[model samples]
Target: MQDILGHLQRLGMSGYEAKAYVALVAAGRPVNGYEVAKRSGVPRSTVYETLGKLVARGAAFEVRGAADATDYRPLPPEALLDRMRREFDGSVDALRDALPAVAGAPEGHLIHNLKDGGALLDRAEDVVAGARRGLVLSVWPQEMARLDGPVRAAAGRGAEVSVMAFGDLGDLGGPRGGERIYEHRYSAPEAVLADLGYRLLVVVGDRREAVVGGFGGDGSAWGIYTADPAVALMAAEYVRQDIALQILAERVGGDELNRLFATDPGLLRLLGRR
Candidate 1:
């Protein structure tokens, strides 16, 4: 019983409130401050104060009797939990509504030159960390390793993640449970190699908005952060195109295509096989 009081306190209940409520529930009757204090091991002088606090917090109710005595009764455990949940949900909604006017902010854009070394990696992380909805990306080993944390963070936040990589991008392993991964040999006839030359892109989009970035080896990167319907539609189209291409290539001849790709020494080396 004492441990139960401590458990309630650990769960964010005030010590006196926890004690008073536990006493009331155990007595299974409307209990006066003196009886509550004696049973709960609370100091007699502070028992009424504790009961008052419990009443204020909705953990217990005060009932008036004909003889000028007031009795306290604890709410049921499930009732208390339900009320707490409702209060928490209401608080969250209110906070969200108030935050926009107080610390509200807008979308951000950043650019980096690849020659900047580790800074390029940091910039990629920043982009992925801020993403919502989904991420569609094509990247190389170095860049992929750098952005791994941020990518997982996005996925943990409920963003859909699909990654296409050339060479090793760390085994498609991540903490977000799972990720949709596409691996290809960069030396293939396709101009859009998973790595080298072209650029690294991370696009996050929802039904109404999107954020897109173009990053490349030259240390040059560009971003368009927008919620405009037209921009989102155009960006979504490209995402659809990429998904389609991945499906097409995989379906056309996954094993045969990979075999042909392996023949290229440069690609095999990039893929860390040679």
Candidate 2:
């Protein structure tokens, strides 16, 4: 009963309305205001008023009988939920059509924090979907699975899509035609997994916006999303440098590349391993 009330409340019902509706539905037959007050523990003084509001909201119907008697019946739960879904969808569509015309003001630079893995993934997908010219990303296999559709969709729409993947992407599947995929070779996937306890993901869209984050195996994740040009450019450059390093590594071979980094004092100091 409490669960039902909670759900009803979420659906925009007030406490008295939810309680009164629950009582009516439990009765499964026509119930007068007095019976609803007694069964739902709603105060007798306000039970009629609550039922009237429920009727106005289409959550209940009032049955008319002889002698001015009115008994109320709740709308079936399944029917009520279906109607709510339809109404919500209609409202969303209406707002989608109406909002853009009213919202003509330019948006300033903004940063948002996404504190869950699902939200991070959602923002990444949105960035990919909105890419007009190019998309660059750094991702691991696990998240790549979730983002494959939007990435492919962006590429299909003529955006240049480039990926710098952290782990083995042998079966990583989505890229086609002009898309570029580079594997990062600085550390083994196992070493990264052990060291970070999480996988880092970054996406930059059309050089305009970016999302950067880490998803942990322990079910905690966090990300920052921003449309600030400087931040977005920094993220884009970070991925660009990773791609450049991969190309250099291919030319010099991984062993020779590591040998140079180890030998060069400046490089060693930059890497903080001196």
Candidate 3:
């Protein structure tokens, strides 16, 4: 019962209105305000107003009763659901048509934070889907699983897609023609994440948009999606640099570079050392 009320609230009903409508639905016949209050646990003082709101919203119909009293009958559940679906779809359709016309050039502060892991994933998906020409992505294995479908679809449509993946991919699949995947030198994602203090995510699309984020072990995540061209280019370059480093390390050898970094004063300072 509570779950049903929650659904109604999400669809734009106040708690009183949801309760009143549910009461009318369960009543089987038209129910007066007094009976609605009793059944729904709403106070009698506000029950009539709540019922009136339901009637106004077409969720309930007012029925004339004996001795100048009025009763309410709920719209059938099937009809209510149909109405809600139509309204929701229509609003979405209208927004799709209207928004792009009004959305002109990039405005101030084009960067926006995605507040959590779910939002982070959503923005990443949006960036991938919006890529027309080409995209460069560097991501960890766990998130790559969730994003591979869209990535493959984008590549299948002939958009150039390059992926620099951290950790074991284990036969990562994509459209055969335009997609390429590079494995990071650090085979385990945890090694890279531990060195960086958090898991890093970077997605740059068509050299125009970018998303950068960090994920933590406690299910907390933070990210930003940016439309600034300079920022986007910088992000793309970051991943490209990583790819370059990976290639160099693979071919040129890691041991000598490790020795250089450990012994060279300039390189040590560059690594944030004393």
Candidate 4:
């Protein structure tokens, strides 16, 4: 069965090891090296060397030995497979133990990779789907429209939902309307909105956070995620400041909103502008 022996060789067996095993199977007994080489078409010297390797590898072993004479046989297929599996599992365990060091090396780093719009949307959806506690989205009208259902579902599952969003999110089946929605409206003066619009959607979780910036423009968008406490705290503070400004804008009326918020100091500081 040269074909079968070749197949075994390809499956990580040494060439002579495969030949020796095949010869043992065909002979149906512990065979000597000369007969193994002759029948399996391996050279005599190579047969003995391969047999030694097989014995060390636990695939085949010598049952008896004398000067220039050794009776060798293959392990049962099941036993061979079991040992192979154990070897593979041991290798995997060793690699897993070394993972932190491997990942920690700075020789080559994986910098930020950009995905197309559709893929980026899928990433955002993944964050929304995994959200456990709540979602705080600072969104433009178009992006807000896309997220309405996800936010509703989050609220349905008892999430504390909040949106300080641009444009009217119009009665997105608010919690009172047989749906779960907690919403807050925030808009700058027309002149301010005309100049700079809210273009971000942020999803905040207890330990995970995803922020999408530059929503609904000429496709200038980027986002970041981090589990670091310091990073999350900074993000939360930025959202808080933006929401506070929006609340004050809504209360003060258009002219007053313009007069007070149009100033670079009030708007810039509140919106986390640097």
Candidate 3 global Cα RMSD: 5.8
Off by over 4 Å in 4: 1-114, 171-198, 252-274
Q: Write the per-residue lDDT of candidate 2 for residues 65-129, one digit (tens) a residue.
A: 45789999999988999988898899889999999989867767889999899999999999999
List, residue by residue over 1-274, the lDDT tens digit for candidate 3. 9999999999989999999999999999998999999999989999998988888888999888778788789999999989999999999899999999998776574888899999999999999998989989999888888788888888988789988988767646533468888888833566777777788999999999999998897888999999988999999999998888778778868877677778999989988887
Against the reference, the lDDT scores of all candidates come to 0.68, 0.90, 0.87, 0.65
Residue pairs with colliding backbones in model 4 are none
| True lDDT of residue 266, candidate 3 | 99
Off by over 4 Å in 2: 1-101, 104-108
Query: What is candidate 2's TM-score against the reference?
Result: 0.63
- Give me candidate 3's TM-score against the actual structure: 0.63
Q: Kindly report which residue stretches of model 1 are placed more than 4 angstroms away from their true locations once superposed.
A: 1-12, 64-68, 104-132, 135-254, 272-274
Per-residue CA lDDT of model 1 for 1-274, tens digit only, reads: 7798777886678887887788899898887888998988889999998888888888899898559889888889889988878987898799988888796464642222344445445544655665687666656665676677777777788888777665556554544444676665424514553444545454444534455555555666655555565766676676555666667666776666577567988868876987
Rank order (by lDDT, best first): 2, 3, 1, 4
Which pairs clash inside model 1? Answer: 113-219, 114-219
Write candidate 4's Cα lDDT for 120-198 as tens digits. Answer: 4556666666676765655555665566677667667776665665555666534432232323444443443456652
Which should have the higher lDDT, number 1 or number 4?
A: 1
Please provide the root mean square deviation of candidate 1 (C-alpha atoms, Å). 10.9
- Give all TM-scores, in the order shown: 0.46, 0.63, 0.63, 0.46
Candidate 2, poorest ten consecutive residues by summed lDDT: 169-178
Question: Candidate 1 at 197: error in angstroms?
Answer: 29
